[model samples]
Target: MSIEEKVTSIIVDQLGVEKDKVKPEASFVDDLGADSMDVVELVMAFEDNFSVQIPDQEENNIRTVQDAIDFIKENQKA
Candidate 1:
């Protein structure tokens, strides 16, 4: 499956959110209602699930779902 789908599933499972609500434009805070801790958990979940380490400097660059998708796609290729 694509990275977007995988990431979306993680967000849904972790945050108890409906699968349909994880659109690319949905903001983690304003749209998805994720708090700071949830955001942290989401990042960690992505890192763990993909077995890729997201550097602290790069983490800030992943503000949107598409950004995460791109990061995973580019980094997860061994």
Candidate 2:
């Protein structure tokens, strides 16, 4: 699967949300109903799946699904 597909899959699995709900513009907190802990777990999940370490500061900026997808595409190990 592509990076965008993988990121959307991760968010769907982690958040227990519908696949259609994993839109690029959807915000983890505001749109998807994720709490702070959920965000942390999601970050860990992303790191594990993509083999990339997202720093603490960068984590805060990843509010939307597109943000996570972009970060992974940019930083994931080949």
Candidate 3:
């Protein structure tokens, strides 16, 4: 799967949300009903799945699904 697809899948699995609802612009908290703890878990999942370290400052900026996708795409090791 592509990075976008993988990131969306992780968001769906992490938030228990329908795939259709995980739009690129959707906010994890405002749109997907994720709590702070859920966001942390999602970040951890992303790090593990993509094999990248997401610093706390960067993690804080990942409010949308696209944000996660972009971060992984930019930071994933070859």
Candidate 4:
């Protein structure tokens, strides 16, 4: 699957939402109904999926699905 699909699934599963609801323009807090804890779990999921450790400070920068995907793409090992 594509990165977008994979990221979408992660968000959907983590937040217990519908896949169709996770759009690129959707905000995690406003549109996706993600709370602070959901955001934490999403970061953990992304770290696990990418096998990369995202520091606490850096986690704050990841507010959207695109942010997660970009982080993984940049940090994921070869």
Candidate 5:
């Protein structure tokens, strides 16, 4: 799968949400009903699955599925 597809799948699995609900613009907290802990776990899942280190400071900007995908696309080791 592509990075965007992988990121969306991860969010769906991590948050237990429907695939249709994991749109790129959807917010993890506001749109997907994820709390702080869920967000943290999601970040960890992305890091582990993509083999990328997402710094704490960057977490704030990764509220949307697209943001996480972009960040991983930019930083993940190929």
Candidate 6:
């Protein structure tokens, strides 16, 4: 699967939300009903799945589904 598909899958599984709601523009907190702890877990899940380290500073900026997908695409290990 592509990076977008992988990221969307992770988001749906991590957040316990429907796949249809995992849109690129969806916000983890506002749109997806994720709390702060959920965001942290989601980041950890992303790191584990994609084998990339997301810095704390960068993690804070990852508010939307597109942000996580972009970060993973840009930083995933070769």
Cα lDDT tens digits, model 4, 16-77, are 99888887777788888888988888888988886889999988888777777888888888
lDDT by residue (1-78, candidate 5, tens digit) is 998888888888899999999998999999999999999999999989999999989999999998998999899997
Q: Which of candidates 3 and 5 reaches a greater lDDT?
A: 3
Which runs in model 3 stand beyond 4 Å of their true positions?
A: none
Indicate the worst ten consecutive residues by lDDT in candidate 6: 68-77
Task: Indicate which candidate wins on lDDT.
Answer: 6
Model 4 stretches with alpha carbons more than 4 Å out: none
Each prediction's whole-model lDDT (CA): 0.85, 0.94, 0.94, 0.84, 0.93, 0.96
lDDT of 3 by residue, 6-40 (tens): 89889889899999999999999999999999999
The collision pairs in model 5 are none
Clash counts for all predictions: 0, 0, 0, 0, 0, 0
The deviation in Å at residue 48 for candidate 5 is 0.3
Residue 53 lDDT in candidate 3: 100
- Against the hidden reference, what TM-scores do the models get? 0.87, 0.96, 0.97, 0.87, 0.96, 0.97
| lDDT score of residue 32 within candidate 2 | 97
Question: What TM-score should be assigned to candidate 3?
Answer: 0.97
On the 0 to 100 scale, the lDDT of residue 40 in model 1 is 85
TM-score, cand. 6 vs. native: 0.97
